[model samples]
Target: MNFDASLWLIFILIGLATTLPRASFIVLGSRVALPLVLQRALRYAPAAALAAIVAPDVLVAGGQVEILNPKLAAAGVAVATASLWRNPWLPFIAGMGALHAVRYLSGS
Candidate 1:
């Protein structure tokens, strides 16, 4: 199959649109003092993004809501482990362990 230049330009434009904000922030640095309220709001960005990605997967499976699923349980354990241990790696291990344990028990 042949790729078209217009398609490449479209892809580049899409990528640039996504990247510009972050790149601009890094370049501008502290010169751009975001408002106090905005700064506070930004503090929740990571959790919000994490929830956006994870909430649906954990809450819905096979077109059914399964809030008590192992994957979600594992994620919670991972978050707790991370927070308590104050170590980055332990959370990953804990999450993986929890997920695998769930899957193993469920035979899925």
Candidate 2:
């Protein structure tokens, strides 16, 4: 196939790849069900996903693992805020605030 056709094919494949899995449950209806333990375990999927995304940026600074960094310190503060208050927004606000405060203080 030509370049344009190849791109279109790839795009369609990606669209189907993402769409099919998500639509499967609805398509399959209630006939199929996950195990109880698996269902319960999926509840933490979002948090686990978020951590998987954020942990790298927070832990790695200057392309290396550093014990002290604004991001790391901010993450700590954010975790503390999350544990203290159940409010979801509080942790985000606290984290960003801590990040900026530490960056400013440390002249980073």
TM-score of each: 0.64, 0.65
Q: Which segments of candidate 1 are over 4 A away from where they belong? A: 1-19, 25-44
Q: What does the lDDT come to for candidate 1?
A: 0.86
- Model 2 reaches what TM-score against the true structure? 0.65
Q: Which ten residues in a row have the lowest lDDT in candidate 2?
A: 1-10
lDDT of model 1 at position 12: 92
Rate residue 8 of model 1 by lDDT.
88
Cα TM-score of candidate 1: 0.64
Residue 51 of model 1: what lDDT? 87
lDDT of 2 by residue, 31-105 (tens): 999799988998898899898999898999989988799999999998899999999899999999999999999
Can you write out model 1's per-residue Cα lDDT over 48-73, one digit (the tens) per residue?
99889988887787889888788788
